[model samples]
Target: MTGRIVRWGAVLGLGSVWWWAVLRLVLAPDAGALEGAVAAGGWGLSLLPVHCAPKSRAGARGVARWRHAWRSAATKASPRPRSDGGSGPS
Candidate 1:
């Protein structure tokens, strides 16, 4: 859940940066070099997350194992069924 939130946040941030850059350039044709450089830097920084993601097959397997372990642990910690199948207190 947290991972999904972070990934979505990154996507939104990247979109915002690009949108701002485009609007600035379009609205002001006389934009300076610093502005252009900042926009370019924003684009490069936005791609860092993608570049940092795990690329190996082992990494994929590790993620799967982690998910499975988490699920199993959650299930194990849940309430169990009553042996007598009674709903009220004895």
Candidate 2:
């Protein structure tokens, strides 16, 4: 859960930076070299997660196992519904 939160945060932060850089370029046609570099860098950096994503078969299997374990743990920890659908015991 924490890993997911951090990854999503990084994606959103980098994506925002890229969008801001693009907007700057679009609004200012005469933007300088530094601005262009920032825009390019931002775009490239935003793709870092995709570039770093697991690609190997072993890596895919590891991710699947992790997901399965997490789901199993969650299922075991949650309360089950009563067959009679009562909120509480009398």
Candidate 3:
């Protein structure tokens, strides 16, 4: 829930940067403005990972959680096996 909110927040932040740069570029009509717009556009595109691949990110998080839960359960099921396969610690 919070993650989705944070993701959207990031999008809006970057989008604002992109739009501002474009507006400046359009209004200023100077050579330097082009460079700034290009740079800001790059920054804006950096947000695409969150916007474009939401499912993949969510799946990765789920996989991470599942792995953690599995590890904890395995450890709790029994004494962890010794590297040498002994019945008990030396």
Candidate 4:
């Protein structure tokens, strides 16, 4: 369960970074920030490099980093998962 949480967290974090990069791109901002995020994410992702099983230390580290990154992007303001199932009733 913990691992699952981390997995989703990392993906969301990376997605957030990508979204920010897109915004920057649209604003005609400096490429530095976008480039930095890409570079850092690439490096971070590569460092541990998840596999079928996190046997190696590097893989474990990578998983941990990924989870941290994801959690950071998540709504710390509201940790609870919002129920947006639908507005209509059956």
Per TM-score, the best of the predicted structures is: 2
The residue-by-residue lDDT of candidate 1 on 11-36, one tens digit each, is 89977867777678778888777667
Residue pairs with clashing backbones, model 4: 9-70
Can you rank all candidates by lDDT, best first?
Answer: 2, 1, 3, 4
| Candidate 4 overall lDDT versus native | 0.70
After superposition, the stretches of candidate 1 with alpha carbons farther than 4 Å from their true spots are: 42-90
Better of 2 and 3 by lDDT: 2
lDDT of 2: 0.78
Residue-wise lDDT of candidate 3 within 15-59, one digit each (tens)?
Answer: 776776766667776638565867676776677755455667656
- Worst ten in a row by lDDT for model 3: 49-58
Q: Which model is ahead, 3 or 4, in terms of lDDT?
A: 3
> What's the TM-score of each model vs. the native?
0.40, 0.44, 0.38, 0.35
For candidate 4, write residues 46-82 as lDDT tens digits.
Answer: 6784556645743555777889978887846656555
RMSD (Cα, Å) of candidate 4?
20.0
Q: Show where candidate 2 strays beyond 4 Å.
A: 44-90
RMSD, one per candidate, in order = 12.5, 11.7, 12.0, 20.0
Model 2 weakest lDDT span, ten residues long: 50-59
